[model samples]
Target chain A: MTTPSNKLPARAIIREVGLRDGLQSIATILSTAHKHTWIRAAYAAGQREIEVGSFVPARLLPQLADTAELVAYARTFPDLFVSVLVPNLRGAEDAIAANADLMIVPLSASHAHSLANLRKTPEDVVAEVARIRAARDAAGSRILIEGGVGTAFGCTLQGQVEKREVLRLMQALLDAGADRVSMADTVGYADPAMVRDLFEDALRIAGDRFWCGHFHDTRGLGLANVYAALEVGVTRFDACLAGIGGCPHAPGASGNVATEDLAYMLGSMGIQTGIDVQQLLALRAQAAQWLAGETLHGSLWQAGLPKTFTAAAAVAA
Target chain B: MTTPSNKLPARAIIREVGLRDGLQSIATILSTAHKHTWIRAAYAAGQREIEVGSFVPARLLPQLADTAELVAYARTFPDLFVSVLVPNLRGAEDAIAANADLMIVPLSASHAHSLANLRKTPEDVVAEVARIRAARDAAGSRILIEGGVGTAFGCTLQGQVEKREVLRLMQALLDAGADRVSMADTVGYADPAMVRDLFEDALRIAGDRFWCGHFHDTRGLGLANVYAALEVGVTRFDACLAGIGGCPHAPGASGNVATEDLAYMLGSMGIQTGIDVQQLLALRAQAAQWLAGETLHGSLWQAGLPKTFTAAAAVAA
Candidate 1:
């Protein structure tokens, strides 16, 4: 294994995923108006990329029932890179219809997790990716397709997911015509060492096509794992506002890394993310009010930004 | 800058500083009996180094008034490395009298913080260390002296503490007869990149004499900062159980990194801490009950160890 480079990227992207990932796992069903406000506030806080919601059936996930509306609302922002989660070709079709910039297809690398969570084998998901690509191409749409491999580290049900297996699925997704690929520690099983080891290889394999790193803060290693991936030149990450999400299968697990906290970390390191953390914290306060009764996570909300924290723009200047 | 070494040390130390740092700032004043239980539980959970309490006047800090009694109690465990915090020569005398393994003399790198917190300038603290060393030598005590520079990253009261000033203070402490030196981000201002840069320089200057890294999780970068230090080959860190400390001056800042969480991070990285994180969690549960109504911090308590986590001993084996 090579030593981790201390050099961080000059800029990075923190794709806000709270609308889909954070809202889906919670009990509250946020209204389309609330989601529209959330998207507006997030954009105001300088978030360029946002996964607004997922296009699953309303019966299965009523919390995300307004995915189409939210996508249309987010698309109104001229420079916003709007995305949505697509479970299959049908969801991808809806995303395209809503004119989303991208649609993410999640595949679980853990065989048991794939069956339990997605109701399909890993290979079956790859085939579905191929079908979705064909459909997108046939529609002559400009929407990008990102195959995000979850359980890339391990799974609660499967205990350990082999690194080789994760890499193989990522390659298969690319071969199946995925425009981009990303990895997710869906169950929060990833440590910095594991992230460094796997993400290094992923970068070698996919290079610039390795789109993002998604990490859950369940065991509190999310930011550290992001730091590890950052060391290996993975610049984009997925985070939830106030860290609101959890795997239903992993009891008591927390959400992804907090968007405000991640922004603070990157800014403090002189890595530009074009985010205003104070503005993000204000949005988080609004989110807490909307998602009352839910356990909100993150430290920056309490402590505020440090006296030494420089804004990303200031750092760049 | 050099690349960060991915090769973590085979073994590292997590020195528990809860009894001293945690109790001093909180309203809850744990009884001597509770402290005894805490020390016993921590030792049972495989923590060897512990700072039982500080040697300040009881009227000033009634919480840590039982420092001498606690030191005597902790000495019963022949293998335990017991330490205490001392403010000046008088406290060092008390530590030497108590036959403590070591005494940490804290020197603030920020002049404003130094005057406000300790009522002594940085140079004054260095001179005090010299007097303490003389006293220790005169008493022929085997107790070691560690000069810890706090606010080494930056200070809330003084904004930014210069790197040259911090390095100069560290060197001054050593020249004043300190047996070892360490750095602390007293107000939780440190980021991982700052940690890597400063700690790499510290390691170069002090080598093995650089005893520890003390970080506060006030802004959520504590564990990530620890990971950066680990990459730079520093193997010792100071943590509070359940993350039960905060700065009196910085109102919203949280405590040091949580002991159980830090243990979990190290074990996950295949570093042998000799700590059973499950046992540490149980102790944390007890600590929570003992200090009820006080806000505690950390993530591992909510989500237990991951399915993929191997015990440090197993990893070493």
Candidate 2:
């Protein structure tokens, strides 16, 4: 019960995945201008890190076909760290060509998910990360590489993924020359204790090279799990604006934790996440208009900020 | 990341506030039969504790006029601990007569809220708790007394509530002979650091006498605040099924954290809350149908459980 004077360090980074994760799952396709507005607004709200879009083939994901354009637009902000999801070496090339701050190569930990979705074994994806790293060095690109192990917990395709297997793949990714590695509860199977145990172990092996915690709010434990990771000194997270993504492969699964809500949680804890929650809610309203038919999720947007919120003064104090 | 073989002790208690908190706030007045059905189903779902109804005047809250009947029904379950909210001594008498397991007298820490909502000063409420305790002793009743300090963080009417004042009020309740005390972020202005600081101090003062953490998801930091409290060793929490019961005075405020969501969080974290989340979801479905126009808040209901979920089996493994 002793009051610890020093605030808990801000280890969590909420990367706004609204434009990519949110837009891709919904039936509606936002105009490129709307995407630009979202990116601008999110950055203005103190979101320095953002996954602006994905670098998949244009025809495969029409919702994100303007990723190249969005990437260019996001790069306009001086300190903003713009990232793009790259599925393969070709996508990596596109990301490198666009000069994204970071390019994440997602590898599903579930064998069934890897085979069915990516058409490659988990090890094969690690091999691709090696090739992508080689290509980046060959092309003299400075963009960072993040090997994201999706479904690191259990998976919709293959239930009960072994933690040992996830840890091995994570190590393999690092060994294969990945600049950083992240574990994701891609199907949202993680709970707080699991997050604490796994992240603590992963950090022991990967050190500061273990980058972010990606959790889906599919089963409502997203923020709880993130808090556990924070307790264990892992900072940086992947979140969608308005909690907008849904798993296409997993039936009845929802999106990542809402970025606005996550920001509010951090800001309330007196942790410096640098994101303005009010501005995030305003941005959500704007995004809602563009995504009229899409189901947007989040609690803070509907509730608004509490009267006692003095973020400007609190930060100054 | 050493996996600690020592299992986390089960500490969560979902104090169901639907009958009093949920029904009183909403326009719907469920039939007595429906209330009985809810109590029965909630108990069946492993919900050992329930706030069946309030003991306010029927004229003030006709929705809870069936409080006596509901309490009687709840007592039918041997292990179920039935609680009731009593605003003053008169209500306390009714609660004692019903042989309720617990009687919570809510006292707002915010002076403005105390005056406007409860028509009493903070000290006046403490005096009332003394009176209630005296009456209980005189009547030879063994009902547990709980002093719930609401608006402990901030209030809509009075913007910033000092931490010293909240702690003083909490100590006042204990001195006034209340069996237990708990803090509430009634206006949802709490951040994790603030929660940690206050709960830590309060726990030092109240020791094991501090019982529950009541948080509103109004600003979307409800789950995060709960986590902070957990870190400080709080286990029991107050949540509404479907996140119902917002303050009528606070226009944009949301309800308590969804009970089913909270249960899922605890269950997933390897903490035994004893409540079945799937059964809670089913109860939510019935509650939704009964309270059709009411805005229900929860994530697990919309997206359902994750594919990785194997009930208690996953956690056991």
Candidate 3:
């Protein structure tokens, strides 16, 4: 048997997506001021990559209306990788104008969810990526474009998404001028075995062009699925602090894997994520207050860290 | 990268331990009749293995006082593998007399936990396993003996259990006449990476003699750790239905990984678990009714099965 010990990546990036993915789905409209504080606190806690907010029309998603402001503020810190989600060229243009580090254009592999979420077919979204790339170049912006395949696993609406279609779309997105691409278990439908099977093949196809993995802990296998990707060498992950996001369609279903739990899991596994879990827990407490009534998820916050966690001490030593 | 797809076991067994582990940690004293219903329902749900209860003194653990009765009742189901926890020789004698399918003698890897939980050192537990083996032989009982190493990853009271010590105790348990041996993440401290590292080594030493894996979902990586063990081909697992048990010390810490969720994860990955998830969900509802006001864990109950889940239909087909 091949031991994963030797093959696992040394360091992984846990990109905080709570401000965007976490807030957008929940009912709470966190004040822009609270968003700023959350960002600053997360950065202070050693987070380098954060998807600040989505660059959507305020009328459509008022929760993330302050994306441009968040991105501009997050840029004050040197070496911070600020990301924003852009549905079409308008949002992508806003991201580029704001000098955001990266813009993720999510294309759902499930045609039904693609049309419902993006108002475009998967191929149509791919075409939009080409347009967004051209627009970025014309604007002389160095903003990276990532084509993230949402519902890469089965979908709540479409049920089973064919792997062949998912892979074919990934290649198309790359051909359409996306600088990077990633897979998302958008509704938390992925299991580790499925993750290993699909991601191993995706890695062979994309190599370094594969940006990260995004998993929703909806079915409670988010960490397990992430472990499968790690086994195949995908290091960067997208998560939300306190696991704040939940599926609007499926009530009680969780959103992204909780950042604190993911960080703890990765740290204990000896993978450097550069995020201090205690500080993340502090941020989680702040978030819980800001979005008081919304049901929050994440196990680490409840249990705290194990006594064997010496990564914090070792860093000082 | 060696893809984990081909390496994963095609089937797995989830041993329901809610009656033993789940009940012991909670304040709720489910009626013996209710436990019998749970056992019958769990058997109907496709769980072949069940840990009926512990053989410790009734005063110490009143919740499991009806263990022998439950074991005898569970044995009525043909093909059901009834197991019980035996803390010492007297408990083993009761198990042998009751004709239990198996009796697990737990040894804590952490010295502090060993003393606190079992009131014996790791070596003393090993000796007891030898005595239990001899007693079973002399009684001409066909019941199997399994030595389980708890806190194999780390302990709450004492942290950073040495891998060398864990392996040493497992070897000692085997040498002391255990028919089989298993490892447990007793405090939910194990990450999937640690599981793969340790379990791969353990599988090398024990092969098929490694009986089962028991994981707590306290920090939400239980399923992930299970996935890691599956990669190493450890099939049998110990879980509590609805995650009934919480660490008594930890106010809200979860108990064993919920059996339903684990089965759903395995079934989703095309692993044949022989259990029907719908049947398990029905059992979960009954459990929720039986233990009202108690915190129940497991994601599937909230969201129900994904529409893509075809486990039931496949069996029908």
Residue B187 lDDT in candidate 1: 93
Over 4 Å off, model 3: A1-6, A247-253, A312-317, B1-6, B246-253, B312-317
Question: DockQ of candidate 1?
Answer: 0.60
What is the per-residue lDDT of model 1 for residues A3-108, given as tens digits with 9 covering 90 to 100? 3558888889999999999998999988888888899998888899999999999999999988898888888996999989999888988988888999999999
Report the C-alpha lDDT of model 1 over B254-277, residue by residue, as the tens digit: 788999999999998888888889
Q: What TM-score, computed on C-alpha atoms, does each candidate reach?
A: 0.97, 0.95, 0.97
Cα error, candidate 1, residue B172 (Å): 0.7
Would you list the rank order by lDDT, best first?
Answer: 1, 3, 2
DockQ metric for all predictions: 0.60, 0.50, 0.62
Q: Of the pair 1 and 2, which is ahead by TM-score?
A: 1
Expressed as tens digits, the lDDT of each residue in B243-280 for candidate 2 is: 99877665666688888888877776667777777888
Ranking of all candidate structures by their TM-score, best first: 1, 3, 2
Q: For this target, which candidate reaches the highest lDDT against the unseen true structure?
A: 1
| Model 3 lDDT tens row, B111-162 | 9888887889999999989999999999999999999999899988888899
**TM-score, candidate 1, first chain:** 0.97
Instruction: Give the 10-residue window scoring lowest on summed lDDT in candidate 1 chain A.
Output: A308-317
